[model samples]
Target: PALRSIVNPDDARFLNPPDMPKAIQAFCRETRQPAPRTEGELVRCAYESLALKYREVLGWLEELTGNCIEVIHIVGGGSQSAILNQFTADACQRPVVAGPVEATAMGNLLVQVRASGELATLAEMREVIRKSSKVAVFKPGPAAAWEDAATRFAGLRRGN
Candidate 1:
């Protein structure tokens, strides 16, 4: 909610800007909010900004595939962030599944298992992962606000 209140949406700087501190300052100035003074606050803004950027990439993938992506899967250490997962679902207006916190280690192990003939195919490996790992699901809320934000984000990416 705090993120929603401060988001300019139209500002390209929010799209993984070269300098986050500057972007935060600019965003605060534009939205008439005091600049974040604490690392936690800055981190929150950074997470929100990253989620919005993911939304943008999802759009590009959808366009290229000519198919709407139904769910987003986030693996690795970052997937542990429930806040970022929820933000991603909200920003993209889609379902987000985050888990396999140690994805890299899991994948490496899975590959070794496969090489040993324990797994016959990638599908089998996926099934093993699905059964072994726990995932958090985030369903999007209302689309109106996120849609508006996405539009602004797109415009920013296009340099409009």
Candidate 2:
């Protein structure tokens, strides 16, 4: 809810005016839509907006690399948010693997282990972590709904 209040549909920081530094404040006000009144609505708006943004980024990456990104891995504390994880899957129409909630800490420890010569290769380190950690997976849902939402979000973003 806190994020929702600050960054409507999602944070406007990514929007490329470069000069405009606000979040979603100006966009919400300009859209003539009432600001989210309830906590649930606020959270929904925030998560949905974030998911849409993720979809856009994924598209850009795929376009740049000329390779399909089949999966999304959400690491660290953010991975623990089941709601957001599921939203990402739905919005991006891809599978999301969320795990190692304390990923940064584990990564640091892994670095030490590697330096100590315990793990010789990156693959070996990944295998060890894969065996030890518990992860949650979210699969994409119906395409129609997510696609429609994406279209609507794109329109809103374009000031339509």
Q: Which candidate has the highest TM-score of all?
A: 2
What stretches of model 2 exceed 4 Å from their correct place?
1-26
Across residues 43-131, which tens digit of lDDT does each residue of candidate 2 receive? 67677778888998999999999999999999998899999999899889999999988889889999999999999999998998899
Q: Which clashing pairs does model 1 show?
A: none
TM-scores of the candidates in the order shown: 0.77, 0.82
lDDT of 1 by residue, 57-150 (tens): 8988999999999999999988999988998999888899998898899999999999999999999999999999999999987777767766
Question: When superposed on Cα atoms, how far off is each prediction in RMSD?
Answer: 3.8, 4.9
Whole-model lDDT, candidate 2?
0.76
lDDT of each: 0.78, 0.76
Off by over 4 Å in 1: 4-23, 26-34, 37-41, 158-160
